[model samples]
Target: MLKFVKNHMESIEGVATYPMISLLIFFVFFALLFWWVFTASKAYIKEVSELPLENDNNQPKEDLL
Candidate 1:
């Protein structure tokens, strides 16, 4: 099974570049995300962190009839 797949890939031209390009893309994406996380504002972080517990609709709850 492995030999069959390797033989098939060996027939294609420029197949080797595909793995390098994919690795470069993956590395750049994660590097940018890491930079953004580190540079983000503390205040903004705190606000986002509290989103799950925040109640936007302040109206009083109506009693069930």
Candidate 2:
């Protein structure tokens, strides 16, 4: 199975560049995400974090009849 797949891939032109392009895309995505995380405001982060708790308290409880 491996040999067959290898032979098929070897026939395709410019297949080697695919891995490099994928690596570049993956690197760029994580780099941007890291930058955003570091640059995000602490106040905004705290507000977003409290959203779940606030909603939980505001929800009405339904007692079974």
Q: For candidate 2, what is the lDDT?
A: 0.86
Q: Cα RMSDs of all predictions?
A: 4.3, 4.3
Which stretches of model 2 miss by more than 4 angstroms?
56-65
TM-scores of the models, in the order given: 0.80, 0.81
Q: How does each model score on lDDT? A: 0.85, 0.86
lDDT tens per residue, model 1, 1-65: 99999999999999999999999999999999999999999999988886765455633234221
Please write out the lDDT profile of model 2 over residues 1-65, one tens digit for every residue.
99999999999999999999999999999999999999999999988876765545554344221
Q: Which stretches of candidate 1 lie over 4 Å from their true place?
A: 58-65
Candidate 2, backbone clash total: 0
Q: Summing lDDT over every window of 10 consecutive residues in candidate 2, give the lowest-scoring window.
A: 56-65
Error of 2 at 3 (Å): 0.6
Candidate 2: deviation at residue 59, Å? 7.6
